[model samples]
Target: MSQGDAQIDFYPATQAPIFRENWPRMRSHAIVPRSKEGWIDPVISEWSLEGAAWEDFHPHAEYNYVLEGELHISVDGEEVVLQVGDSATVPAGKLGRYWAPKFARMLTVYGPNPDGEESTDFKYEEL
Candidate 1:
């Protein structure tokens, strides 16, 4: 799908392509590219590692839907735990932290596509 074209994209039962990876933390699969500025990108992601944390300032709003396991997230000081079938949206420009006790699989969409760059980007601290 390109910019300014009205069309519907289809994905079969095949696997999605992995777009980014950071060992023992998270991996992102690209479902659709954020072809333009201020556009969200659809992605599938996996979070692993017990007690691993991701602390960062989001450049865009992140919408997540838990697919497999549990995800514990902290936005600024509030804590929220999401399980399978739960969905949440982390607003833009917030300091956030995410940790998984064991593992989690999720469908995520980033408004303005956080990885809308020539290569994958990483902007978080591990604790």
Candidate 2:
């Protein structure tokens, strides 16, 4: 089947598309097409923060791929800096935090939950 006609589909970002001229901004778009079953849901998010920090997120599971820039991600107490072309997985029920030193963009997948009832909420501190 032709590229467009095949049952399998393709996304430009999944195959390494060139970043837009105005890259590094807070933006997101759904990756996997939505469905009733909701087996897998992926979102592409870009973060451009000079000194932005996030509150603790207790999620069931989070899969992330760094597309550009650098990010400080902390799970529990240990922290790591993820750069472009890097990937990380945060397990279920873990406390995680994220910050952007300069700018960053990441593709995140949240799903494959067996119970299908996972959710997340942020707890921010007063600045």
Candidate 3:
């Protein structure tokens, strides 16, 4: 497959190099990397972590799927648990946190690149 294809396939148990080697430290990694101007494009992200408290605001909505294990996600004070095979979407403008008492792996899709000119206001909040 040529680079920059609109779609890419991955093997089972395959962790993209960027994520396989740094999942612990980075907790997350995005594949089909996007250029700074590729805001209209979507990116798939793989995340593995024990626990994390995050406050993020984006101009585009985010959709998440639990690849393995489970995640207790809280969005704007609403709590939900996503087990393997489950999915959820956090709309743009919402703030949330994700916690996994045990190690968990998940895949996420953002409607738009999180770091594009259209989303210049995207930032992690202090809360």
Give the alpha carbon lDDT tens digit for every residue of 42-90 in model 1: 5444334344555566667778788878888888689999999998888
Q: Is candidate 1 or candidate 2 better by TM-score?
A: 1
| Model 1: worst 10 consecutive residues (lDDT sum) | 117-126
Runs in model 1 deviating more than 4 A are 1-6, 12-22, 40-51, 112-127
Off by over 4 Å in 3: 1-26, 113-127
| lDDT (0 to 1) per candidate | 0.63, 0.59, 0.65
* Rank ordering of all candidates by lDDT, starting from the highest: 3, 1, 2
Model 2 bad stretches (over 4 Å): 1-5, 10-25, 33-50, 56-59, 123-127
lDDT (Cα, tens digit) per residue for candidate 3, span 1-48: 567766846634545443234334226657644566656677777876
Model 3 reaches what TM-score against the true structure?
Answer: 0.67
By TM-score, is 1 or 3 better?
3
- Evaluated at residue 108, the lDDT of candidate 3 is 85
Arrange candidates, best TM-score first.
3, 1, 2
The CA-based lDDT of model 2 is what?
0.59
Best model number under TM-score = 3
In angstroms, the error of model 2 at 83 is: 1.4
Instruction: Choose 2 or 3, whichever is better by TM-score.
Output: 3
